[model samples]
Target: MAETEGKFDFAIDRGGTFTDVFARLPDGRERVLKLLSRDPQNYKDAPTEGIRRVLEEESGRLFPRDQPVDTALIGWIRMGTTVATNALLEREGERTALLVSASQCYPPLPFPCCWPCNNERISVGLRSHKGRKEYDLQRH
Candidate 1:
């Protein structure tokens, strides 16, 4: 493994049951880690703990679990989580709705305007100023 020269880049996925981390060091080396998402006994956050562990191995130093990790060594971090999906499935979060409008003649709207991701609670509506409604959502 080549020694660290610059900052490290990390991509993380935090799921309901587990958190997975993928790191790319300055030397173009990659590392991965997976841990329980809710392990409060040993660590407060799984993603942070996973990053700390990777950094320790990359820098060959023991980072105190209580102390914050050195942000200077991190170039960037991209994270994704399933919290929204979990919340929607469990009906635990605040409801949100979005309304969008656009012209239909100038730049025609795509056919099948409704997205496949739409569910009973989500919808897409289209209305033209020409007094013609292309897609009208009926809320139940």
Candidate 2:
């Protein structure tokens, strides 16, 4: 009753202040766990610690002292980190992009609409974008 291990599929997301763990067992049962992204004593191992905690839950055992989950039984594992979001929030992300469109708009930009455009129905089909067959960018 204290220890269990089996095939599982897991996904991990490390946000700025939290680490989320989502797992699906071979029996079709699913679980989600969240842990603090940062601890007072250790900052570098936050993600690892969070994962270990989730694994402990999955195996129904206390980790480090108890046997860890069997990685070989894992079917798939996907993970994501918030380093990009953190960088952008801290104004340290790269700013390089080109946004171009092969389309047309009547009112033009930077102009105020008479609240008509604000209407969802009016705005949804506001753009009279022609069919793709006639789509082109000919700078005349």
Candidate 3:
């Protein structure tokens, strides 16, 4: 069996609904865990809880919820999340703006609009048009 030089490595994927964890132990053993993203009744954070579970299983010792894990034992952890994508899909966040080169073509949106330009620097200003706030992009 391949060994990990006495360190644990973990790869995690945290989505809007579920979080998955994959761990590699020092002794070449592998573990996987899946849990709910939001389970306040059971755990405060899914990734942390998952790591705790894996460590407990390896050491055969139960770790208390309030105690911090031995991070020194872990070699590395890679994590990814879909929270931002979910927020964007649902349109549940604050108003935002994007700045790009004037020569680039961007698909028009109903609320925030952009105009075609040929200059290098574009100055953007907020204007009230027909009782609605709009973005006025002008070349500088």
User: Model 2: per-residue lDDT, tens digit, 23-53?
Assistant: 7776778888787777756534554565566
RMSD after CA superposition, every candidate = 10.8, 13.3, 6.3
What candidate 3 gets wrong by more than 4 Å, as runs, is 1-4, 96-140
Clashing pairs in 3: none
Q: Could you give candidate 3's per-residue lDDT for residues 1-140 as a string of tens digits?
A: 23347888899999989999999988888998999999999999999999999988897878887889888878888999898767766776755565545556555433343344555688779988898787666667
lDDT of each: 0.76, 0.57, 0.80
Off by over 4 Å in 1: 1-5, 94-140
TM-score of each: 0.63, 0.49, 0.65
| TM-score: model 2 vs. ground truth | 0.49
- On lDDT, the candidate that comes out on top is 3
Please write out the lDDT profile of model 1 over residues 57-134, one tens digit for every residue: 889988888999998888888999998768766767654433333332335433333233323444547777587546
Which of 1 and 2 is ahead in lDDT?
1
Candidate ranking under TM-score, highest first, comes to 3, 1, 2
